[model samples]
Target: MQDLRTVLSSDTIIIGDGAIGTMLQSRGLVAGTMPEAWNSERPEDMLAVHRAYLEAGANYLTTNTFGANRIRMREGGLGSDVAGTVERAVALARQVAEGQAWVAGSVGPTGRLMQPLGDLSLAEAEDVYAEQIEALIAAGVDLIVVETHHDVEEAGAAVRMARQLGNLPVFASFAFNPRGRTMMGLKAADAAVAMEALGVSAVGANCGDGPEAVAKALEQMHGATDLPLLARSNAGIPQLGKDAVTLWDIEAAAMAQHAQRFVSLGARIVGGCCGTGPSHVAAIRAALL
Candidate 1:
């Protein structure tokens, strides 16, 4: 497989997969469930998720290993199986893609703040990421993405680990609120500069507010760095119904418009996040192309 950096430089646009954790939750997965465990226990379901994104026109499908690091796995009583889960997650993604799309090993934060704000030291964070990276690399993923990160320190740690482990390209993405600030209070520009400074191939925002808010953040990030940008925002502002949360079809069209603006602002990769599905991805693909 080609390196993601090389591929992106040659391609006009890249289509990233939509939200996985929340999408699974919508399909009867309870909160606090260890999603990675499904990679081994229910491989078909994991494969189906990846296939849906591919069929929807995603050029890259992220592995189901976002929370597969030992620390997070421990919280779900699957600490000892983190390595196995990570391996299976990558393998399943690759199987589903079957040369049709790139498999990006997804590594997320440990759900704990880094030093000075929480008990986790930088060194400890690095070790946790290294464990996940090793499994992804051994499984031969085409690239790695550190996403939904709130803390700059944790994002940097994952980037460093990716660089050390393999020659694969790394993309670091942060999550933000409607105010255009991360949970850690880092601005969009700051996140861009921080990730680029760590030598990541690309940096952008994901899993944050709806299209409008993320588009604003992408504009700020575009001014902050020269690296390729990625934006995967939610379908729209989520609506809480009596029994469930839902987003209307109009939101998907609105997101497509936002995706076009993101491209104009220099985003090379675009897709949907929470409250988004194949329909949202299809809209983005149509608008971007």
Candidate 2:
């Protein structure tokens, strides 16, 4: 498999596969459905989602195992199939990517907070991350991304686990609200520098806020470290109405323009997160050209 750095270096890599929960909901998955469980029950649909992104000009697709950690799986009644679910997620992505796109194993933060601030200790955090990383590596993921992190300490622990397990390139990304800060109040530059010191292959912002905010965060992250950058912002700020969250296409396009600026600011990987589907990725592809 081509390493993520090699694939990204060829051109600005356009990552796809986001809004897993929403997409599944659109397909009749209930409010509390375990999207990851679809790996065992509805593998074809998962593969179809991956193919859509690939066809939309995405150079990379993350597996649908973001919340597949043991802790979350138990809540979803999938605790027994954690490794199998992760392997299936990777296999399905590879099936769709074929020779076109690279598959990145998606590792979201464990729901618990780390020590000195919460009950979980550093050692416990390491063990949880190790389980996820081992499954991704065994499934032959081209790369691993630890994303949607809110706590700096937890993010650092996850990256450290990745390094100890293997040399596969690891990218660390955090979610930031529009206020220019993460849920834990860590600045973008602080997250970037900390992840860089831990030897992450890339670091940047993702999921929360619009592209403009993410672009500004990228600017803050610049010069914090020499590592490559990754940016995956939402299509727009979502609004809740009539029991649904809605985003506008025009807003997403405007965000794409900011994504172009992110590329200019030196982000090697760019894509959309929540509220961003194939259309958002297509816009990014158009912008790249």
Candidate 3:
């Protein structure tokens, strides 16, 4: 098989796997439990999730390390074990993906607001990101996926840290509101411009209002930056569920429709986020193909 860098930079559109956290929850991961912990504790289930996505035709497999940073891991009672945990997570995904799929080391927000907005300094934030980025690169991830970041500073920190540590391809994505704005009030074009400035391979939105909202955001991003764009939308807007929670009721076909819309707009990467599954990814694969 060709290398991930070549494939990602090629004209071919790539399909990323969907909703690892939710998939773990459905497979008996209790709510509020840190999903990254399962990388060491319940790897069988994690591998199962990877297999599900691969069988459903996904070409990129994100590791179960979304929240494996030092600060977050320390809070989860796994502080001193960060490296071990990350390495294990990547190994499991690679074991399942083999050479057929590329492993994306999933890096998430550090859970602390940056300076001027709150407290954490930019230098400290970069340190926090570097620890996880190093572990992911050492563990052999094909790329770094900095995702679910609502703050441009936070995401930029991660992307830059990855660049500082290695030459791997990195993708940075933000969560947008329905109006195509981030929680920090950054518009789609604004966020894309920021990410492009950080030198990431692709930039776009994820886990927002759903496909339509994400499509709208990416359309704006397409006009703002020349880099490849990624569209990883959620299933739909959330509806009330048990325990005062919310759930997505969007079906496979519905999400697939927007995947097509994203591709039509020249998005290079497309997939689902919250409340998505193998079936949704399969539909996306079918739609794009």
Q: Output the number of the TM-score-best candidate.
A: 3
Each prediction's whole-model lDDT (CA): 0.85, 0.80, 0.88
Candidate 2 per-residue lDDT over residues 140-186, each given as its tens digit? 88878899899988888889988898888899999987665898898
Q: Give the clashing pairs for model 1.
A: none
Off by over 4 Å in 2: 7-15, 243-252
Q: 1 or 2, which is superior by TM-score? A: 1
Error of 1 at 171 (Å): 0.3
Q: Would you list the rank order by TM-score, best first?
A: 3, 1, 2
lDDT of 3: 0.88
Q: How far out, in Å, is residue 192 in model 2?
A: 1.0
The residue-level lDDT of candidate 2 at 109 comes to 80
Report the error of model 3 at residue 228, Å: 1.0
lDDT tens digits, residues 33-139, model 1? 87777787778877788888999999999999989998889888776676788888888888888888889999988998887888999999999899899899999
Query: Could you give the C-alpha RMSD of every candidate to the true structure, in order shown?
Result: 1.7, 2.0, 1.5
Question: How far is 135's C-alpha from truth in model 3 (Å)?
Answer: 0.3
- lDDT-wise, the better of 1 and 3 is 3
> What's the TM-score of every candidate structure?
0.94, 0.92, 0.96
